[model samples]
Target: MELSAGKFLCLFALLSVVSAEIFFEDRFDDEWEKRWVKSDWKKDGDGAGDWNHTAGKWFGDENDKGIQTYPDYRFFAISAQFPEFSNKDKSLVFQFSVKHEQKLDCGGGYMKLLSGDVDQKKFGAETPYSIMFGPDICGYSTKKVHAILTRNGKNHLIKKEVPCETDQLTHLYTFIIRPDATYSILIDNVEKQSGSLYNDWDLLPPKTIKDPDAKKPEDWDEKEYIPDPDDKKPEGYDDIPKEIPDTDTKKPEDWDDEEDGEWTPPTIPNPEYKGAWKQKKIKNPNYKGKWKAPMIDNPDFSDDPDLYVFPNLKYVGIELWQVKSGTLFDNVLITDDAEYAKKVAEETWGKHKDAEKAAFDEAEKKKEEEEKANEKNDIDDIDDDDDDADDTDAEDSHEKDDDNNKIEEEATSTHDEL
Candidate 1:
């Protein structure tokens, strides 16, 4: 059955929107506590693994909802499983925000995308994942945005080194893998790096390789220089010594041959000395360019334009170790629409970043004032204790005078009766 031209066009557009729709999203609201499972798998064997809610110091709204990681020897491996989906020919968009309020030292702030079946409760470093993307900071040496893809049981790391934000502020990380095997990494919606998967990762054997049967000709000359037969070594070159006694030298006056050891002059570099003589080198007339291997189609290589595709994606996880916590993760989204992901970031982080910064500043200022006030009060308390001790001494001196007055009053009453 054939449809009318107008109806066929409408059908195509409708399917496009459906396919590009947001397949998975978690704003990490209050209800997210139930949806996300905190894995008992801790790497350090010291735990209390958990995720805290914050309005985000960057946003300053606890109700907006983001999970905060705690500090000090924690290995948090938590996962949230969703309905299975695949990249297909559509673009895959993954976006999320991370904030390190505690000024993290060395830790991992990455998230993972898993395929097929997964045990959410038991997810750990050993568990398989399809993709792992985010910033990882371990000292100054390793501050990079990791974009790793799992292909054929091996993890393919991004060839290009991408820098990440290390300040105690919020930053958005976006990874977009297109159907054409090209990918882009974005920081706060700005593209930082973009390239092809085949070039950036060793996903498959090279498309072309050096032909094993091809070899350089026997007469091929790679040398840039050749020995000059006309040039000869100078006569008596070996007669000159590399070092000789100073000609103006004289023994110290303190030296005595019988009772003391004789003094010898220090050797100086000989002026007549020349380096070991050799024939001079002239440019090689038969010099050819450096030999290059001839490239041929690799027999084991096959083209897969959609190497970035991952069929049956079922879960997303945040499994990492932290030395200092206070990392907030929020606004997770997976979709085929790049514009949609950008809009979400603008609405959430872009809109409130400045205000949140101001709020953080205000809080810090207030804390400083309170500490000063407490210090002043501590000094005042000591002064008050000293004043109380002086008052007690004055009361003790008055006690004897009061007892003598009472006896004098009783004696005066008996004199009036006499």
Candidate 2:
């Protein structure tokens, strides 16, 4: 059991690396139900949507399954707890993969990280969270990654618009926040957005603001252009009427002044008339440029050294209202290493993406063919109905003719008898 100093240090370093890389991870294996708790928040009313553990209708691997929203127009709430940890002086990376199998017309595909203990059964939208990140899609207007951070009991949304993947295929979304107050948003392992927390969120007042006491001088010539003093209105400019009687119009042949209400000619816009004129603008020599209040350091602004810290993060939850369901969430990872997250994304989403696309395309093709076949069947049914109606009409016509013949025969026989 004796070991050299170098060997012991190496083993300790390896253990630290492994521990630091992964804080919480879930591939959503068969034992997911043991770890996850489905909330009964909306179960009594309107019914809470259920989650299906499957790889979906089309996927690269059948066994690579995830939890999917099963029904449309229902609220879903679920949470899973992990050993509590904090990102006090470390880089925090939160990532997951989502596939909007229903095309996600309007719904939230985001996940929340909650601090402290949670009432899993009651976990819903009202439950507080330390950080919320992922894609949120709604029609054509809203398709962006949400990166919200909670500070002082208030949630602050990222000010920058970071667009996300809206495709039906699976996509990897990664959000990374560092101890230095910088953050990044990645979609499919590509950096979509990166900036400082102070600049991106309104957690603190602005560092600089327009000087409240400063004002533009009363005689400051801010206007860049002024009316030409030499310009004057023409003598006949006001004389041209906007409308005049059309000379091409003629009086009707049957026109009677008393009967036809004087037979006035229709009016037309005058060709010679022009809109109201203004003196041409010329550059002003005394222009002092656009005046602005000088900026000064904001007195209300106070930077926090621990802006990126989220202490006691414990649970990860999914709580949202979906208009149309079929969003699959899997490969959830919370770590301190960005590279490890990327590797996880590449192994799951990247490795299987192409095969998944191929499967999706095949499914689409099959669906299209089925739709066309159904349309054809409907058309044939309509044709068959028309043919049946025609046959019935022909039979009715023949019966009517036989009745006419019988009546004519009876009349002839009576006449002959008479």
Candidate 3:
């Protein structure tokens, strides 16, 4: 059948659009495809294993038709192995889809991009990481969408949870991990959380252990070569004489600064001393009068290891009230920059005596208040005990009355019967 002119153009445009669509398999070489190793969770149950590969048409599996069944409540782990990847790549992006049969436990089965021995013999008893997604199904509603990305050996986790309907087919979870050590998680193609540990200087390198069998070269065949004693002697013995260098240069006799005139040293300066004087000794005043550079000796001042210097303030006073009504000095006083020894001496001598007196008065008032609070608490406790005792007495009296009534009734009945 021949199409109309407009129909032909429409068909042509549709084909052009389809041609632009990218096929994932076309981008990577066939060798790259071999890197992936598929794991079947169903294999653990039915020896004849399969996977639900219908959802991933971009990447084909070893199974024909690319269709498989999913287990009732099981998880499958697929790992991408690149033996050379150890030296080639440090960071990678692993994205996949997950649909649970039901909200199981707070211990929702964990999915992790683990890099360790995939072989059972070399597989470690404990994996280096099993980064968790949530506490349990209770952590979110039954139909919830969650995505998490763990980086820097899975120590750091970036998670995002959204309302999702479990029955609503399949959805994608994507993670992008960078070499700079920043990781991000995306659920359903929408960006979620992003974090980094690149700034931490003492970070551990992400590692994936190989199977013990993989320690040696793949081509190592014992039958190919025979061990001969002569062949096993040493590597360089064949050309040892030719490998040695001739000793022709003479050794230097002594070190000489002038030999290398390109460098120079600077002159040094001599030390100088100044005059020193004998330190003067100070004394304390006998009474709390004007503060004087302490007198040579005074008995009225306590002999206890205290040395105080009282400096007097001299002024021509106009009124008695201006001098603070006869200058009442109580506590000790000392300069702010006084040395430890000087401060001890001043404190022992009761420096700022007036200040100390005021402090003592305030402390006395606080003590009285505390004593009153304690007495009130004690009285409240006593009242509580008295009320308890009164209730007990009342209960005992009621019991006694009950017994007396029963006894009277019994005595009356016996008399009637007789």
Candidate 4:
């Protein structure tokens, strides 16, 4: 039986489709309320734990509805439980969109992947998560992605610093964990960081390390250069002053000799000054190479090729502590196909991210224009006050002139009668 080329190609495509799984997705539609469980955790002293759930695009973009945390210094959590699945020998993608409507001054714009008997009601910052992936910002600095993957009961944070978007617009953050123990972080469908999980995270302690017994050999001259023993400092090296009085300065003519004290000229950097002299350096002839401790097998390290596997993945949640709120999370997806995540990002976040940015820029421009207009109005008010003051002065002068003319007429009339 001969199989045609067309048949073979079709078989390949079908198998590829079968290998990947779309485990979970939420567009946060109107019915999204039923899907997510908002935690009842309270802030300090019984403050309200708020989560602002929206039923449409944020700021009027075409993306779906999203949930936003509210109130300054509050604890928020929302979770969705799903059928358990494993990500062994297959790709895993955890993707979502975040918009810091308040521009995120010290807050988290990330989500957590929780599993193993998660009580949605009890979920909070204390609840354990399998993966926590997204951006975190604080103060003036500290704007980076926080990718924490839990393995063997310990959460290992990615050592490589992956920068995150700080703008007020919606951004898509996707974390891809491949079957080959490699991971990639994507911001807006573009790869920001990619490397082996083994190298980037301390998922497992180092496989090998410097031997504890090794030590540097005696008399190993590691210095690259040393001061020349024969070289001497040039004569008069100490005589040069670091700074000198400015010879071009002349005393002001208004200075009084007796009343005013003598004035001194401002000091200037001395042109004849040379830096403190020292013996010149010479290459060390006895220099040896840098010392390195011999490596030996680490007894504690045991490599597990399936270090990236998660057997009982059940839920994906957004559990975070936001100092300043107004962080929107939506378009959450958990799948085994990398391309599917990218497509969803494009159709949703990728589609509306630019429009969100334009809206933000437009708002900023409008604010600046209003400020300028207000300043101009203030200046105009000041000018109007000045004009009023001048008119009052002119009125007073006219009144005085009339009074003087009346006095002179009265005196002239008296003289004519006499």
- The best candidate by lDDT is 2
Deviation in Å, model 2, residue 39 alpha carbon: 1.3
Q: What would the per-residue lDDT of candidate 3 be over residues 157-204, giving only the tens digit for each residue?
A: 323344442321223344444454565555444555566533221133
- CA-lDDT, candidates in order: 0.86, 0.92, 0.35, 0.85
Candidate 2, position 83, lDDT: 89
Q: Tens digit of lDDT per residue, candidate 1, span 1-418?
A: 9999999988876666555678788888778878888887863556746777876554656567789887567788888878899899789999998888888889988999999998887899999999999999998799999999999889989999999999877889999999888989999889999999989999999999999999999889999999998888778889999999986989878789777776778899998988788789999999997998899999999988668889989999999888887888988998898877887889887876787788778877888999999999988998898788778867876776777777788778788778
- Pick the TM-score winner: 2
Writing each residue's lDDT as its tens digit, candidate 4 over 363-399 gives: 7899899999999999999999999988988898898
Worst ten in a row by lDDT for model 2: 12-21
TM-score of each: 0.77, 0.86, 0.28, 0.75
| Alpha-carbon RMSD to native, per candidate | 10.9, 4.7, 43.7, 7.3
Listed per model in order, the count of residue pairs whose N, CA or C atoms clash below 3 Å is 3, 0, 15, 0
Q: How do all the candidates rank in terms of lDDT, highest first?
A: 2, 1, 4, 3
Q: How big is the positional error of residue 28 in model 4, measured in Å on the Cα after superposition?
A: 0.3
Candidate 1's clash total is 3
Clashing pairs in 2: none
Candidate 2 — which residues are off by over 4 angstroms? 1-19, 240-275, 407-418
Error of 2 at 247 (Å): 8.2
Scored against the true structure, residue 51 in model 3 reaches a CA lDDT of 37
lDDT over C-alpha atoms for residue 76 of model 3: 33
